[model samples]
Target: MFRKIRILLLLVVLLFVALGTWRSDSRLASWAYVTRVAVYPVAADDSPTTAQFIRELDAASFAAIENWLQREVKRYRQTQQASVQIRLGAEIKTLPPGLPNAPNTLDIMLWSLKLRWWAYRQEDGENIKPHIQIFVLFHDAKRHVGAALPHSIGMRKGKIGVIHAFASPEQTGQNAVIITHELLHLFGATDKYDFATLQPVYPQGYAEPERLPLLPQTLAEIMGGRIPVSRERAEIPKDLSVTRIGPTTAEEIGLLAP
Candidate 1:
């Protein structure tokens, strides 16, 4: 009789623990999630131009990016009555060395754990604890730079990401677009563009699929490749001004009910 009682007690405790964990995870996924993000700049290349560009990095450089996020949240809230927000934390220094440039699945998990520990140790008490960390690595224009890990989003412990771009004043606006793209990936948004043809998909990818003439789209969907110039062609927007979140993306990110 005592053995049976002990087994029952163990099961009861396990059930309670599972319930508590589920409730906590549900709260994080709610519409009121206000995620805090920190952006850090690093010179990927050792060239003089890249070094100088990294030196010019400041909080002001990301102001437009922050503003764009605010506007997007506000727009969605007004239309769908969802109250999600993105709080941009202060710009921090580059992360420590030894982080993998091209991490595999195991490397990603290990790197995320190391990054969270490193960030917490670097905090000076004045800075807010970020829910997400974005490491922006700047490279020279001569170097071909086209790699941002969408898989790095929404890791265990915390959300972490990386963006690689050219180190030039002219590329700042375009870089902001890329940053915003990766930011959405952290919130469960998937890509809407085709990998083979690099064109935005139909219906879900189109910003205004209900329009009479769907040949030319006025705005680019945030998850899509770019604004559609034709049924089969699209062009990258110069900045976030020409980008807007589509209904599919908003629903995926919990900003709208499906």
Candidate 2:
């Protein structure tokens, strides 16, 4: 009877040890949460008719932004083979310029650190506050009149990787790329395009782990943003190539991956 009891106790301890090891090694250990986005209204000075027009445009812009975000989440999931699912919320109220130095000049910028933290804390369990990212598009005109403007992500570490954009609704199409670009920045992905020359930034080691090419210039990689290739032939740049990454890049940064 004593020997049997000892054997059972030892088995229980070993089971717990194995469970702990599995949990530690599991790639899906850190549960992936959904991203919630809220678009607060900014200060604008236009007539009621103009206001209606702006509202319509804003609605369209919101749709485009949501669609783009979903697309990016899908792409990332495919590449990473991650079990972490991304949930997204609707476009909510727009925030007023809280800072004294902030522009009342039809352009709004969200400092990733500021009051945004409060926004998350204030929420009830009714709304799960996953990592949040804010996207802002600034335009002075009728909200649909201007060239698509280029934006720069602020150097400060961003939560939810906010991108404060300044552009008209007509130019908002390119804003999708900008939004995804900023969000990815939070994930430690570098830009494939160099800001200096306004050209592609093709470093040999740009793609990590998978050695996937960063652009069409080398191999067939989505990081290059090439998709829906023609049925007949897929044209990729000869210079682009991929290499195998053995525990570096994301894993090195401790992104809680599988």
Candidate 3:
């Protein structure tokens, strides 16, 4: 009897969250003033370098993401001077909930709900709370040596993200790219890259699709995450300067939706 009652209550809570977030999703996608983003950093691995990097972080460290969004907003001719504001939140000692190894639809949905609840509990005695909460897990590249970082994820409805990034200073530029990519996902942007090949989709993913001999494209679409340099190969963007928000991505994110 107790187990049945608990299961029923859980289902009710899930339904309530779904309905509430359905409405919140529209507002978030509308580019409203409540688009403040709070970033919380966590050391994914126990390394001295990672701890130091997190300790040294400040507003200036993420300035690239801010500058990039400001530029994109102007380029798209949005009403607000800046639709997105990135700020640091209270330090989180523990890591956010991670995804299952092979998450099915139900698993993903449950994880999303748990993630949102976890985010709410993480709020400290801050005067201003963030509308979008991004938990960045930084791994020490110097000590651990070169290894592929874990995948990052963002939720459109809940406006939360768990981003895996490197703690090395040199990787900050690329980290900004991944962070911005997940940030855009929170705002309703879809990935423009092929999951199988990890290649940027043509036309929508290409920064300049109209250019002659489109192979060796110079810039990457912000949602695409790759600069196509050959038929089967692409380059990881060095910085936000080498990335652009294509029309499709802008439209999806409500930037082009006057």
Q: Compare the candidates by lDDT and give the number of the best one.
A: 3
What TM-score goes with each of the models? 0.72, 0.44, 0.91
Give the per-residue lDDT digits (tens) of candidate 1, residues 164-231: 77789998888888888887776777889997887888877777878778878888887884888897
- Computed on alpha carbons, the lDDT of every model, listed in order, comes to 0.70, 0.39, 0.85
Which residues of candidate 1, in runs, are more than 4 Å off? Answer: 1-28, 31-33, 79-126, 145-157
What tens digits encode model 3's per-residue C-alpha lDDT throughout 1-258?
999999999899879878878876787767655468889998898899999989999988887898888888778864664467788776688877777898899998788777888888896577787778889999988655666788899877777888988898998999999999999997788999999988999989988999898889999998988999997998999889999999999898877877
Off by over 4 Å in 2: 1-33, 37-54, 57-126, 141-167, 203-258
Alpha-carbon lDDT of model 3: 0.85
The C-alpha local distance difference test score for the whole of candidate 2 amounts to 0.39
For model 3, where is the 10-residue window of minimal lDDT?
76-85
Evaluated at residue 248, the lDDT of candidate 2 is 27
Candidate 3 residue pairs that clash: none
Of 1 and 3, the candidate ahead on TM-score is 3
lDDT of 2 by residue, 1-258 (tens): 999999999799668746744543332223253334444332233445434434554444556445544443444344433332233333334542244454563433343324444344433234544443353434454444465433435222334333444435544544444554454444454544334533333332233213334233333222322221232233322221221111222343234354
